[model samples]
Target: MTGPTVSSPHEVTDLAAVTLLVHDRTRRVLGAFLGREQTVAGAARETGLDLRVVHRDVQALRRAGLLRVTREQARAGRPVKMYRAHADDLFVDARHLPQQAGEGQAAALDPLFHHAVAREFRRALSDFSPGWGLRVYATPDAPGFAVLEGPRSARRLSPLDEWQGPPARMLSGTPTAHLTTAQVTEVQRDLILLMRKVAEFSAANAGAGQPVLLRLGLAPLTEDELRNLHR
Candidate 1:
């Protein structure tokens, strides 16, 4: 059986870093290092790219903090640097990031905020593939991952209301609200606290239950309709 794909959150902090990761050669170089450590020469061999090109691409990834220097081995007359991908996942929020760069409040928001949002977007896209299981939020309090069960598995599993002993709806609870900037900030603060509580509970019961897939997301809608609705 295939293993569950693991993803570690890595944020795109700037436009330049984003550009570098999306570049064809750099992306391949990063892919080659995922889940394993490799020397520059090994990466070049795996990618079937020129040694010089692989060296350059790896350097770029290293500069962007996307590659970790795993160790060093002396070969010939010099030490060879072994590197690995810093994260298995890259989360970029092109849709919600500020149009212009600045060092201010937006930068001060939880560094992982956009990363979580991007994970949710990724889950939505992955659901389009066949053989993928149905995605469902286990609980509103736990936002980081969703549970995925095949149709047969889903049938065996109890619904959320049955599992949690609460009335649940298949549809959303309420329409999106228009809030002031301060209100939005306050709401985010509450969400962070809730997520922390759920995380603590999850950690304490780490292996007590079956594994579930989840993607946490919280973002202000920027659609024209939403913007027009803002008070």
Candidate 2:
């Protein structure tokens, strides 16, 4: 049988809609409905979320116009409402969002990205074997390694005590420094060049390497945060 028909990408321009779509749970609920119609219970089961939580997220998504009730399914107690995503994908246009709202949206979306990276790392660790090692080159200047002899080696690793994974390449770092505005601008330009080079390399060697997710971010520290660093 054919699957449910999904419309093309939906363009979301409303600030409220953008805010709602960036929320982690709302995104997950909408994902569960994309390309298929599903009841709240089905979404809950697929996402492994609580039934009440899924229902609440669905209602919020519906109100945001990101989801729609497609049909009703006959069930034992009552007719179950089947929901589908309004489109197969969402294209958010926040170019005109107010400064404060844009910042709020970024803050709301940051954790979701972090969670994705953490989840991938955990999954990689699940297949870990003895004598495996993890090497992280946070930056060209600083490198770190966590070698695992076996499961029992966890106790000697301190902060990385719980880390166990096959040989892998990873980059992560949060380096704070004081810099002039011009220096920061130069660094930003270099970062852009680095991103372009990475993209070009990936395109040139498309099928040779496994998929990897890369996230890059830069921001100045708040005055309060900087002050705390000295204490």
Candidate 3:
């Protein structure tokens, strides 16, 4: 039997749908079905999730209109249902949600975001190789940073046993700057524009390069929060 019609770039505006999509497990189940049909058992295998968890996620996704049963296969006792995503891409819009709902979305996403960042950092360190540097530059329009790969000849040439430790080191620092309201707004605008450009670049280079994670965060601290930093 033919499945329901699938589309590209599904626009998700329902609050229920948005809530489901924010979850990592639901996304994993939906991803397993995207561009292909799969049974609950099959999705569990592909995602390495428990069968019961996959079943629950699939049901939730179907109810959210993010998934559809494509067909049913006749088996010995019952028919096994096949499922597929409603669209290859999903664009979730939560701007219309109430303040409480928006906060809930953020709370749901916070752990997943941090987990992804941490996973990528661990992966990078595991595959760490020497010979890279960060280049910071500022043009009249904006300031930016780039990770520059050093030449192979300049890379670690010593034998493993001769080295004292891993030559690569992580670069990170947290510096707080006090600014006027207008200055804060300007910085936020610049960060938004930078994120947009990064998104465009990722789309342009999709499927052509190694996977990389880029995360940006900007937040203003309250007086109490700022004071707590010292204690």
Candidate 4:
């Protein structure tokens, strides 16, 4: 489906712009560049924010352990402090424990709580996403997250489901491939959108039975495919 525009593999989008702006525009910018590299000017231009603002945001990200800054002097320009995302610290997701809410109680609030939580999740994920597809979260590990795929970037995917997975370095933002921030953002958005739908389904099925046991998880891939990332 048509979705947010993607400018760079690491561009911060306007999906949940307000919340992305929660830590100010710079953190949002940092969100776009999580797990990669950039500079104040490069980030500013990519994220469509101000250079000064990018600088401030980088500082904040550094404090939040979301960014790791280094220096580089390209060709002949003065040395510049380059920034890369620390990843784990930049963003987060949660588990779908649903509190157990007792046995029958689970079904009672399943509908309302599902909707409320889904709405909150979307609002949170849409903050910096672009175009991405859906992967339902039917597990305690990696539930309701998306793996973004698009053109012109690498680092392709982000988590939309509750954080906590099988330690897949790539999914955990270890830069397994040349995935882009845009891709990650898209994945995250798709995740949120999918969950939104799930919540809708839950709402429709209220008072039906057994609280609809939905487990969240990542799309299954093979060892060869994952290993291919190096190639």
* CA lDDT of every candidate: 0.68, 0.74, 0.72, 0.54
Which window of ten consecutive residues has the lowest lDDT sum in model 3? 161-170
Query: Cα miss at 53, model 2 (Å)?
Result: 0.9
- Candidate 3 — which pairs collide? none
Candidate 3 similarity to native, TM-score? 0.46
Per-candidate TM equals 0.39, 0.44, 0.46, 0.30
Writing each residue's lDDT as its tens digit, candidate 4 over 51-127 gives 78777767766765556766676666667777777542322222322233244555665576567555544454455
How displaced is residue 205 in candidate 1, in Å?
49
CA-RMSD of model 3: 13.1
lDDT of 1 by residue, 1-231 (tens): 999987567777776667666566788988988888998889889899999999988888888888889999988988888899888777777753445433354565545545554565456445533333455755546575566543323344467533322221111222477789998888889878877886777899976864433324456787786768765
The sequence of per-residue lDDT tens digits that candidate 2 reaches over residues 54-156 is 9988888888888899999897998989999988778876674455744776786668667766776566566665433443323334344433333433334
Best by lDDT: 2
lDDT of 2 at 54: 90
Candidate closer to the true structure by lDDT (higher is better), 1 or 3: 3
Report the number of backbone clashes for model 2.
0
**Residue-pair clashes per candidate, as listed?**
4, 0, 0, 23
